[model samples]
Target: MFLVALIFIIISYGMVDSLRADYAEKWQLDFQDPATPVMEGIINLHHDLWFFLILIAVFVLWILLRTLWFFDRSRGTVPSKVVHGTVLEIVWTIAPSFILLAIAIPSFALLYSMEESTDPAITLKAIGHQWYWSYEYSDYTTDSESLAFDSYMLPESELKEGQLRLLEVDNRIFLPTHTHLRVLITSSDVLHSWAVPSLGVKVDACPGRLNQASIFLKREGIFYGQCSEICGVNHGFMPIVIEAVPLKEYVSWVSSQIQI
Candidate 1:
């Protein structure tokens, strides 16, 4: 039983990298490939943290088994009455503070990178409905007539052979790779959240309020995610499908939607 458990854990760990690679292949923005220095740095730091946690867990488990039997109270172990050790308390607090700082600095840099903007060539406004998504371009003033569309979840029977359920949409949002886009997201009814893990974005869609975020797709591929917040019965049906295409293809797709 122990051997079987160990084998399963090892196999699962080995597949983790492949799972990440699959996401990369399916959703890496055309210009924002995994090879970018910014994303690569973040992924590497995440890997390091995972390594640290796994090593600590294994060491602690080993110590528990190797010492528990020898230190059990029934086996004559005595309790110590040292409840409040100021030095120990201070040490634990300060160590965690340093550790958090180590994680925070890199995280803040990535955040700033996402927020940086010189001049965005395009803008998209996303409206979250009870169970659908509406997108408007050119400040959503109708005069721009840039492009507007509603995206509904594709029904199970309507899904393409390779399309996964709960992630398929009727009209997937299209955007150009290597371009910075400002997305203004708001809710039509209740609160919802628009999140895409690959893009490292998660922002709330508030009712009657406009919230914006910038996305710079460096790669070209399809990325998928669903409404992250529980709004209602159909919340699970709200999926966001973004296809980052080459500049030419994206522009053409936008033009095609304008005719709709």
Candidate 2:
């Protein structure tokens, strides 16, 4: 009975978070952008080890119950009078070391991939100000125009239908799909963090310093984020939105904006 209840609790917690996440994905998604394959692999690693952990927990529970039912001192059971043995000692040590190595090897590979920026097709620089985000496309240049804009949060009354309350920005950064774009993040006023969970990109925006990360969007979508640093009262109002589109559409957007 207890085990069943424990399982229910676990299922409830998992389903609750999954449901909320699904709701966010359905209602809040302005576009369809799948998670990167490497991020999916990282999640698989977590699932694999968690399965082992659950197995270990079940095994431990069985051993405790067996001892209580038939081998306890109160049941007049004989204590295992055996002492240390070379084989048993070696088995315990070697088994755990192997498990640790198995988890560590892939973990390192994923970590390295997250920070790797090798000859990216484009680069975008983000600057965190008092409350808004300023973006400049460093990869594009022209004598007649430049792609730089300040993105501010849209007022609730001014927001479009189905737009998120605190997650919509006036000027969303646009990037082409299936392109490796490097982002350099920094702050002009204080500390802030640039994070969009689906893209698995998060880096601190610190003043007098710049941090970089690479993002390769697998599909076109509207990814939302907020100014993760509490700079001031309006901190809650500064939202970040990125509209990833096709290459041709992205170029047309640049041309349309620059002519204005």
Candidate 3:
């Protein structure tokens, strides 16, 4: 079993650099490709923590095997002798403390970065209903000039060609790439969560209260997410789609909506 695992690890290590996924797959075990700075940092921190986790697992397994082999009745004719070394105790305690410290530094940094909003170029408000999402642009001075829309999931039979069943929505949120965005989320009736895996955002929308988060998209693409929190019978029907475009295209889209 150990030899088989060792061979598997060796093969996987060689293929690590070549294994890249740009989007989510049907049976994906890894994270969807990150499209924002915060998501990139999340991926990096995940890898860093996994390195320590694997190291600790391997060390613990080796110790278990060694103890079994040496302390077994078949190998030892005499009773086991008690041994306690202060250096070993101290080393174990201090080593774990340093490892936790190393892990904490990056964890705290990512949390702070996720919450940081600096001179937002755009502000988007997402209101969650029992089964749909409504968005509003807060930049417009008047209600008539502002853009607002409700995104409803398309029925499986209504989905067009190439559209993902249960994932397609009539209206997708559009944002400009390489721009700072402040998103405020709130629930109208029940609790809901707005999440996008590629963008690494998941904020709960509680009733009568607003939760804010910041996003800085680094690339242009179509990203999909679902309402993570269960609100009602149609909770699974609410899906979130974000279309990231160039600044010029984004402005053109807003203008067209305003004119309508």
Top of the candidates by TM-score = 3
Local distance difference test, each candidate: 0.74, 0.77, 0.87
Q: Write the per-residue lDDT of candidate 3 for residues 102-202, one digit (tens) a residue.
A: 99999999999988878899999999998999999979645545578899999988975456667778998889999999999999998999999999999
Q: Which candidate number maximizes lDDT?
A: 3
Which regions of candidate 1 fall more than 4 Å away from where they truly are?
A: 1-42, 62-93, 139-146
RMSD of each: 8.7, 9.0, 8.6
Looking at model 3, residue 24 earns an lDDT score of 60
* lDDT of each residue in 18-137, candidate 1, tens digit only: 222213235644323342334555576677677767866897799899688877878997757789999999987997788778778877887787666547788988899998988877
TM-score, model 2 to reference: 0.79
Tell me the TM-score of each prediction against the true structure. Answer: 0.73, 0.79, 0.88
Clashing pairs in 1: 29-219, 29-220, 30-218, 30-219, 30-220, 31-218, 31-219, 32-218, 32-219
